[model samples]
Target: MVTLRSHTREKARRSTWAFLPPEIRRMILEEISRQRRWSCASTVCKEWHAIVATKNLNRLELNGASAEGLSKIILQRHLVRQIYLNIELPAYTCPQCRGFASSSEHGKLAKDALRKLSKALAAWEPTHHITLELNAYSPNDTDHCFKNHLYGFKHENDGDLLEKQEAWDDQRHGWVKGKQVRLPTTGAIQQLFSTVISGVQGERPQKVPAVKGVVIRRQMRRKIDRLALPKLLKQFPNLESINYEPWRVLFHQPDLLDSSCERCDQMLQDGLPKWPKHVRSVTIFEDFNEQIMEAIRSGIDPTISSTSMQIENGRRTRYGLGEAFAVKSRHLEHLSVSFMIDARDFFTSCKTLSDWPRLRSLVLTTPLMTKGPQHRMSDFLVKAGQVAQKMQRLKSLVIWHCSHDEASAVIFLKNKRSRRNVHGSATLTWRGTRDFDFSEEVVETWQQVVCTCNSHRGYVGQCDSHQLLCRIERVEGEIISHGDAIHHLRLPDGVIDPTSLRQIRQEGILQREARAVEAEPVDGSGEDP
Candidate 1:
């Protein structure tokens, strides 16, 4: 009896251990963190809660509730390495009055919240890296009012803000006044250099540590005043990466450049031979202006040579490839241009492509369908093929919203053939859309094309297989009966021998055996043979 009792206790303990080991449990908890409903795991037990609160959590998603909950979470000062916060700015209202706050009040609330968050972040972890994404929807009256209020508040409180505002004020007065303004002189630039050097030499904590990157997106409104940028750039000396879409007005007025060019000319004549090279990457989202293009064409000082340049809204204008990129070829490593150009004009004007030996990435976004009969998409493809053949160092190329008919594909294939023979390695990604029925021949041809293209020494690969598989999978579900679906398909005889598949069959056998064992009579009756 004592032996039987000990055996029963051992069996119960072994059964309890069957669920999962500690390492397995931790992995399951970590996997749950990737999903949006991670909080559901929190309710499972204390063991789960402790696992979920670890510092190195890879995926952090903040929904509406979590945005408000962040204040509490930050207080713990947990080692949160990465955080992604998605906040939907609620309709602003005063908590005290419980009434809809004025637009100004709403703006004040936003600014105060950001300032408080910044302070908390600074205190919690000075070295903590963060990527803040502010996703605001289409602006309404409230948004406009809020922005105005924020502007007013910054103008009043922040002295640094006043500098940019003063620059704008100077631009408004045409830069001619008894204003006694303090412009960014040579002495100030020298002082900035000294400050950076001192910080480096002393090995002291930097006042404003350099950010990894910053992205600012705003809807189209007024034109961005070019006069305002120099001062803003000066403030963030440690800035390495910046992406911004300033308002459109900056592009509409050509006169802004006329004045700027005159100013630069005067400065150059006075022996001020160099421009500041603070920014390494730049993206300008506006129509190309001829005057500004002329300034760049005159020759960019080697000191300020930019590595990346992305120009959008390059529509029908005199500022084509010849006028825009011909001169700055040596400096640009990545270039993206969107516009319509005649095939002949593009080939002839963009002949200096050899200068950009370091260029590795190129993107050309052009119209797919031609409205008039004069210009055809085929002609565009031929020209694009010629350009690709010339760019020997090109690794990644994207042609957005463009048709890739047989002729276009042939042109690309020709480039691929040449690249294989010469460079021994080159990869290109082609994306397109077409309306065609799915057939065995089509599938075979696509597979052949993919295999042949990828067999080359430098052929990285293509995405046709994965895309076609997805389409076929979708169609399979639509055509097949529920019972005959691919998920329920039995393996072929040769694919897996019955003997190997038989192991899982034992589970059914055991279940039947259990039923038979349970059904045995109380008198211990023998099985009915």
Candidate 2:
């Protein structure tokens, strides 16, 4: 009887659900969608199914080996909007190569997969905003970063999280989590991380991502390069954008130039490739430097925000990414090719940021360095500020530090066009340029350590506490006082906040006066009169 009553209640509630206000019903549906329970929520009633029908993209699944079926959808061009590709290419291994991975089964499989996709795309137009999310890897018997993160059991009970559901599938011979596959060990699976592009000398520039239980070889990277993925990607003139996560990437400059192709050779000489004219955005970020992370964890005195972007003949050959983006296209708006170019060649390559009128957002991440800072933050900001001055339509400009756990400089540009904002006065414009945030403890530490130089020479070193300000301000150990060091970070006068400047100046004046009083020798007269 209790079960019957419960069923009766549920049936009555379903009818009453429609009686609720339209806005309330819509809000409920939106909440469900946000939680990614769309499939379950949409089936509740006819009204919901109608609302969600368009949002759901039932992507056509196709294997890379048999992508010929994709060409048949040419008549129904609208159906080409979304696609999920499953690729399983024939492995080509050469034992004589002797542990060299480019000829390994993994590299061959990745190449074959891309070749198949290229053939299929020959029939399709490049105008669509299509993105291919590649889940390319096979089951291998080893404790790798990919496997551990995918299937590791959760030990942290304090945090609220959803348990991952996985099961053993015998047919696929792997651990399956929905469509994601993780097979148990063997040499059957080839390693893509070991692969590198042509002309990329030395080790495959790769670092393990920051995750629990990640096992990376402690020894330095070995020199064995040659993966055709980079060169092949550049050949796709139809490719409008590159979407990749840097932390998980293997190479800093994966778009390596191939010497074999005559067309590529010609483009290299021409200073620009045959990139799509309609390309709007190109963003690429670099993985964190391990040294930077170690420094921060060890509480190093200096803030290692700066890095040397040293190139091994790192000169801007036609292969430099900044040169690739130096096209004179009106359709280009947002451009970001980080870690692809260093500060040395980047500015010279794209010396025409002012020319791109429609560009609204710009993000850059320079190459990583093993040595000390290449240039001061002040000089870096000066170059960035010059770029900002000419950009009329630019709204957001970001420059990431080439290190982990270090603050990056960000500038927020705001334009107020309305006269009403100023009580029917002249049109007003607002701009804000600020550096990274500092913790209260860090600020307190700096504030406590006033420069102890009597003659106004840089002498923060005399203080009992080791001040980190000089390192951050980076005025070459010549820090006169707290304010002088801070003042080194100069933005355009128009963008700098007047209140902040005044506060800093006031503090400087007070520090100088106190420092002067402390240094005065005793009169010994004992006469106040």
RMSD of each: 24.3, 18.6
The TM-score values for the models, in the order shown, are 0.39, 0.47
lDDT value for candidate 2?
0.36
Most accurate candidate by lDDT: 2
Those runs of model 2 whose alpha carbons end farther than 4 Å from true positions after fitting are: 1-55, 58-104, 111-128, 145-190, 194-239, 244-272, 288-331, 349-354, 366-375, 410-412, 416-529
Q: What is residue 443's positional error in candidate 1, in angstroms?
A: 25
Q: Which candidate is the best by TM-score?
A: 2
For residues 1-529, what per-residue lDDT tens digits would candidate 2 score against the true structure? 9999999988898789777889998887766655544756567677876555334433444565665665565544443345545444233333311122443454455445545655665656645434553434333321221222221122322232223222222224333432223222212222323432233223332211110011111111111122333443444544555443222111222233221222332343343344334446554432222211221223322444432211121212233444555453234566654444444345555565446677766655433221223344434444544545455566555444222112223333333345444222111111112232333433332222222232145332333232223212222322222223224433223221243334334433432332212332211011111
Query: Candidate 1 local accuracy as lDDT?
Result: 0.32
Q: What TM-score would candidate 1 get against the native?
A: 0.39
Residue-pair clash count for candidate 1: 3
TM-score of 2: 0.47
